[model samples]
Target chain A: MTASPTPTDAPPLPWTCPFCALLCDGVALARGETLELRGSDCPKARQALAQQPADTAAATPTIDGRAASLDEALDAAARLLAGATLPLFAGLATDVAGIRSLYALASARDAILDHLLGDAIMASVRPLQDRGVYYTTLAEVRTRADLIVCFGTRPAERYPEFFRRIAPGEPRRREIVFVGTDTDPAAAGPDTELEAVPFAGDAFDTLALLNALAADRALAAPPPGPLAGLAARLQAARYAVIVWEPGASGAQGALVGEAINRLVGTLNARTRAASLALGGSQGGYTANQVVTWLSGLPLRTGLFRDGLRHDPWALATARVLAGRNADLLLWVSSFDPSATPPAADLPTIILGHAAMPPVAGAPQVFIPVATPGIGAAGHLFRLDGGVVVPLVQARDDGLPTVAAIAGAIAQRLAAPASGAGS
Target chain B: MSAPAAVFELRLRALPRFRVDLAGVTPLALGALGEAEAGRVAIRHGNEALALGELFEIRRRPANAPALHFEGDLSRFDRLAWEMEDGEIRVDGPVGHYAAARLRGGLVAVAGDAGGFAACEMAGGELAVAGSVGDFAAAALPGSMDGMRGGTLVVRGDAGARFADRMRRGTAFVFGNAGDFFASRLVAGTIALGGRCGAHPGWAMRRGTLVFAGETPAVPATFVETGHDLRVIWTLLARDLARAGGPFTALPDRRVRRFAGDIAVDGKGEWLLPE
Candidate 1:
């Protein structure tokens, strides 16, 4: 692979930060001894870039904690998969191409596929499945939302550039309300008015009141003062968007999502309103989309010889690991080095970031792969689940992409073994 | 009705290391196969394909009806009797998720606890579990429009959350306690609970009848008390449930206080609290 122009001798390149789900493409990055951010000073982008030094040593593949050739590692992985009674393919933190290839391998090996953030992703998905949703994209929120309600989360904490990304180009009056949470200082602008409402009871209780009030239901007792005002404002707004982060919603986040959907549905009856979910970071959406389109089922589905079966709760990564339901685990994490596989006694194979530290255990094969947007060009679905953002490679690290490694393993699994191989 | 004599009995040889998919191994399907052919029938064990004989010891017996009996700790087995159109299936031990899902017509009985999504989206059948069940029992499949369109589901023990979610049509009886969001977003159905239940029962329900036969649950703020004139409706439902025999046998003698309105959606659903 040819190397791109280094930052020491060239100007900062227009870059898309793959650190978060926002995938902020408005920034420029200069790669020198340490990565420098220009145009936008998002701390998350800086922190992520700081982890990837300009002149870091490349990682090599290993078998059973000892150094091995890539071909040798692939062969060992294929052997493990072939013998596995149930192989779980998880930690899917790679781009679109990586998930596509992994799905093919999952089908070939009859593996059960799930993302590391499956729980958070399911928080949004469960509601969409139970009752349909009225959702809006980031662009829609940026251009047309007159009233914005951040429910149970401060988006800027995880997504540093969320407020900046949605800052309206033309100055117009916008009311920003925070429910069951404090208002984000980042949301303060010249034309923005902010307010916060305390929860009526718990989240469920509060949402129940809100849904009832929005639908004009005559409650025996009057609703909470702030919630009633918020409902009235929601009805009055020209275009309203309710922003929620599923990861922040706790164990019963799906219920929170459903409540948000109910509120949105009720408001849409009278006026314009929609919800914006902030999650699916680290290629969660990419894997879900790819798996769904390929097999007509979402993640946490098993491609059995009998047929496909999808059980979100039973097939959760934590549940599966606790039950020892799977005998082998194939974990792929190419974006973040800190994202490691959970401790399990099963035979494990990891296709991960080049800078990832050695994981402790035997009967494991570790193959370091290229990080998309940093070392190789790729595409990722944005948090809004609408647009696919093109990721530009900042450098050529010469590490094979996850797609290549997974594809190679699939090839090895399909091919007839040579005499005395393994 | 007394238990139909089992035409085929499948006893587990050993505990499987991985979950087995017993979806197509229904009574009618297995009854047609000879002893040798039945043993060779393919089933999924984890990711690998295995013959039925590898996992179970199959014994055939002459019977009048198409029936199959499973004897083992089948907690690692999933999709049991899935999509079975007609026949009788019985399990002596616990079964995993999606058991008897989409069952069009049949009788599925489990003596032990059932895993999540048990009898999910069942169109028509009679499913009875002697023990408890996990979440989403008789609920819709993920992204599906309706749940338990038609059937009779009776859980003698407790039930988990989201029970009968989006159920359009069915008559379900949970004789023990239930978790939160019971009968949530219910389109239309008749569900009876014989014990205490968790919060938010009958939430966002458009149409349905929820009968709390044991303990009256605290009604949500969205629902309001209505006149107690539903005796005609209650008598019709009670007659059928009483015949099923269990906690529901005493339901006919009880008077009920009625409440209506999830008003958040369509507020026509009713919750009958036994007084």
Candidate 2:
């Protein structure tokens, strides 16, 4: 199939936006010659719905820089992987099924596995590993937390509807405090008090001092003079929540997380408190949760014969290429249009978004894959790491999903070398 | 028939974010595999996947002992001997964070300084650092309720901030100075420091032993000085400390003045001062 054949008869289905980790499933989509999205005003969702597969020229898989049939392309990709002594499977940005199939293939080939946001995701994960994390779902924050503190991040920028959806109609309005410089006064619900504690220095020191001061520990220098009141507010609140984004926290981010963990621990000594770490965008949480459940390790894991070995730093696909470690690179990005395969000087195969532009002067294989929520039904985990949302098939984009393509490749790999399947 | 000792050496190339977890890649484990199969051992550096042979130049030789040798500066490498169960890991240079963290069993020796949280949360193992180490050495991992539950961490040089914070059960020996909040929130463990320590020793210690062989540290107000005889415990502990060598070689002969408190939390942890 060179191009996605348009389906004219399928009924309109409620769509799930895979552009972000929220997995907002309330979107209503109208499919036709052109797609239309409604019910959600998120710019990301609109952009995702507007993504159209490239023309026939771009949809066809290319091998050795030449357009080829799907069978020929799959065979070529399989052969490249079969010959590779060490293969790196990176950019795991597809749906749940896709990643599962990919993992099976990687296991069969004993390939190294990772995700595009593995580093960013690991920033949050490292803190979880080093010290433990105290987390509450968005729903709990809405109902329970009387105080909300955002540390070094503005949730509205990333989770656009965070403030509106979280504390919209609480009984006694939740008090909002921003530990960093940024603030959104309007996000504060009616009768809710909003305060900002400006801190633009190293987060490690700030958080550490805050924990000490809050715990009533005597320190020569405490979190700047302004934050002294923070401890009092925390003690007064029935339920307090501290929110932070590991990606935005400056150097010593993990230490900042440690400090937050300590702060929560100290608060729990007397009253109720928890932490809310915000950045789990781009299916990062889904991938991490899935991998953690399956292999008892998160992303950046190497499938060993004995067991899975997780190393957030060492098993990176980028590092593998730069260090000349892996002989083959398999990149998968089947979500957003802008999710393109990273350019690397290695034998590479890309199962990428249809809207991805062709790379210049690279002898890499490119196979355009279908968008999960838009073109096919799929499952994804939300940022909370607990909720799993379903994507209803809204339209027949005629393109193959990453799961299908990966499944095909895995089947081909398992088949006899001279089988008619190839 | 005994399996030959296979030396699995990892030489530093450049620092990567995702640490390499050599949990299952032990000398004993790899020694049984074929040369090619051993070379194909999977490892991750940052978000990249790599084979054992790709990052390090492998030279497997026959020996009687199983050990993993790390050459060159590994200050940026985290989790050097992560969760290691069996074998010996020898580092020639400074190691990074979480070295031998959650280690169940084995001997991890670093010839140079180690980064933060070295030997943290280790259940069973012997981690010896020839040089100073950063904060939280022999302490619990962040979020973990208990720090080093079991194992022995010997730091030849000074320790940084919050040394042995939240330790539950273990023996930590520091030959040099220690930073502030040394032995803070000690749940249960034995820490022997041969040098001066910063403020707030045993801040909220629930139960543990802090042996100071160097300058006298300020005792927290929560602790009450008691002229009691802990001769049996001290003598036995001093003997163990003496066996560790370095400044501890003379620890058994020194007279100890004991003060118990950390009454702020549970008031059970003790501080032993060399008289």
Best by lDDT: 1
Off by over 4 Å in 1: A1-10, A53-55, A418-422, B1-6, B228-232, B235-255
Query: Candidate 1's residue-wise lDDT over B112-184, tens digit each?
Result: 9999888889999989999999999999887888988998899999999989988899899999999988998
What candidate 2 gets wrong by more than 4 Å, as runs, is A1-13, A30-34, A54-57, A170-172, A185-189, A221-225, A250-252, A360-363, A418-422, B1-275
Report fnat, model 1: 0.59
DockQ of each: 0.52, 0.11
| lDDT of candidate 2 at residue B93, scale 0 to 100 | 94
lDDT scores in order:
0.87, 0.75
Query: What's model 2's TM-score?
Result: 0.68
User: Which residue pairs in candidate 1 have backbone atoms (N, alpha carbon, C) closer than 3 angstroms, thus clashing?
Assistant: none
lDDT score for residue A391 of model 1: 92
- What candidate 2 keeps of the native contacts, as a fraction, is 0.09
Q: Name the top DockQ candidate.
A: 1
- Model 1 complex DockQ against the native: 0.52
User: How far off is residue A246 in model 2, in Å?
Assistant: 2.7
